[model samples]
Target: MKASRDDDPRVGLDGRLSWRPAGAADLDAWAALIARTAAVERPVWFERREDLAQILESRKNPTAGNSVLGFDVQGVARAYGRITKNPDGEKALGFGCVDPAWQGTGVGSGLLGWTEARTRQRFAADAATRAAARLRLFTEQQHTHHSALFEGRGYRIVRYYSEMHRPLDGTLPEPILDDGFELVPFGPELYEAVRQAHNDAFRDHWGSEPRDQEAWAFVVNDPLARPDLSAVVVERAGGKVAGYQLASHDAQSAESRGFTEGYTELLGVRPEFRGRGIARALLANAMRRFAAAGMDKAALDVDSENPTGALALYLKMGYVAVNSSMAWDREF
Candidate 1:
C-alpha cells in the first residue's frame, strides 16, 4: 500500500478512513484526541499538548529531526504518532490510541506501516549509512495489545524496564554526604563532569554505551531538559566531583495530556559512591523538587534487572511497580 503524500489524505480500508501528516491546522483536534486517549488509558506516560506542539514546530523546521503523522476518518483524526530522529540521527517511533471509536478499522496498521516506511526512508535512504538505521520504542508491559501491535510490525524486545515512583508527603530523610562529598545543582558548567559520571556509572551495564559529549550537551541544553529539576554533585569540605541524578517533569505536562506524574530521566551514582546512600539521597532530593512543583506523584523507568540494585532501591523508597516495558530489536 502506498503511503499518503504530504498533500494527500491517506485513504485506508474500503476508504472508510484516511490519514495525513498532522500539522499546525490540526492542533485542536490533535489535543482533543490526545486528551481523550490518555483519559482512556489512565496512568500511561504519553506526550503532553505542549510537547506535541513543540514536536510539530520541530517538524516544520525541516532541519529539526522530529516528524508526526495522523490518521483521520473523514476529517477528524482518530489515531496519531511521530518519528523522532535525535541530533545524532538515531531514530525512534512512538504511536498509540485507536479512537475506541475505530479500534480494528485498519487505521492502526496503516499508521504503523506509514511511520515505519518513513523511518526507513529517512535513515536507510543514504547508501553510506543505511546499515546504521535502527528504530526503537518502549511500551508498557501491561499494554498487551500495543505490545502485540509492535511485535506484529516486526519489532522485537531487546530489554525489559520498569516504571517506579515514590511519594513525598512524609518526613524527609537526612542526606549523608560522605566526607568530602556534596550534592549540587546540574548546570552548563558541569556538562563534561556529568557526562563523564554517566559513562562511568553505566559502563558495565547491559547495552550501556558511552555517549558523545556534544550530543550530551544538546540534551542538557534543550529547553525541555528542565535544569531546575536536574541533580548533580560536587565535593564536600572543599568541593570536588562525585556523582549525579538527572530528573525531569513529565507529570505537569502529563496533566495537560490528561494525567499527573513526574519522571526520573536518569539516576546515577559514581562507582566509588555506591552503598553510601547517595542514590537514595539524590532520589529524595528529586522527590522534594517534585513536591515543591505541586506534583502529587513521581515515576522513573528502570532496568528491571539492574545489577546495581536500583530496582530494589526504588521499591524500598515507596515506588510500587505500576507498569513495565521492554526494549526490542533484531539484527538489521
Candidate 2:
C-alpha cells in the first residue's frame, strides 16, 4: 500500500511523509531504522540485519495479511511497522516505532493504528477466524511510554516474562535426573515426542499457544538450533518424554554484545511430571554443556509468575534477572 496524504485510514501520512510497502531491498534500511529505535527505546535488546531480514522474510505472503510498512520523511526512512498471524491464526501480532527524533510526533500512533488495521484485515479474510481473532503487541515493562501507549490504545498486560543469566566460569553441580529418567541429546527418533513434550508442558501456561508440527519443525530445523545442546529426558520405566530445553544462540548477537553464551530458548516439564526436578536437571545439563563449549554464560527467560516455580529454580541456580518484559494484548 502506498499513501502520502492525511486522510489515509490505515495511517495518517503527514504531508511530508510517504508510506510504502516494505520489500526485500529495504532490509538494510529497515535494520538501521529499527536499530535506531531500539538503541533509544529498549537498550537491553540488540538488533542485527538478520533480525530485520527474518521479519521481512516471515511476512512475505504478498498480501496485507502479513506485511510491513516503512514511513519515510523527506525521502529518508525513519519509522517502520509489521503485522502477521500466529501459527494458529488466532492472533494478529506486530509492533511499530518511530525514530527518536520523531518520537513525540503522531507517527508512532499512526503506524500502530495502521498495523492493527492490517492485522484485523488478516482476520477478516475469513469469517470463522475473524470471530476468534485477537490483536497483540509487546513492550518491556520498564518502558512506561510503550505501556502507556498500549493502555491508551486499549491493550492490557497479560503476563510478565524475565530474562536471566549466570556466569559459567565457576564449577557447577552435576545434573541429576529422576531415579528412572536419563538425559539424552535430541535425535530424529525422538522428534515427535519432543513436540508432545513441549505442548503438554506448556498446555496450561499463561498465554501459551499450541504449536503444530510445522511450527515445531521450524525451531528444530533453524540453522542456529543445536541438537547437541538441546536437552530431552526419557523416563526409564515406560520411556516417555518428561522434559526438554532448546539451546540456541545468534551469531550476530554474540558478536554485537561481545560474549559467548548459550540461551535456553524453551524449557518445559510435562504436566504429569511437574515438581520432580526435571527442569532443574535439564538446565544444569545445558549449563554444563555450554561451559564445555567455552561459553562464558548461560541465559533463559521465565514467567515471573510461573506456576511451576521455574523463576525460583533459576535463581537458586545462580541466575540473576538482567531484564524484564511483558506481553500486552488486545481483543477486537
Number of the top-ranking candidate, with TM-score as the measure = 2
TM-score of 1: 0.75
Name the TM-score of candidate 2: 0.85
Put down candidate 1 lDDT per residue, 143-169, tens digits, no spaces.
Answer: 677777878878888889877666667
Residue 320 local lDDT, model 2: 97
Model 2 CA deviation exceeding 4 Å by range: 1-15, 55-64, 71-75, 87-90, 130-133, 187-189, 237-239, 254-259
Query: What value does the lDDT take at residue 160 in candidate 2?
Result: 83
Q: What's the TM-score of every candidate structure?
A: 0.75, 0.85
Which portions of model 1 miss their true places by more than 4 Å? 1-18, 57-68, 71-74, 86-91, 126-133, 187-226, 236-241, 250-262, 270-276, 291-298, 330-332
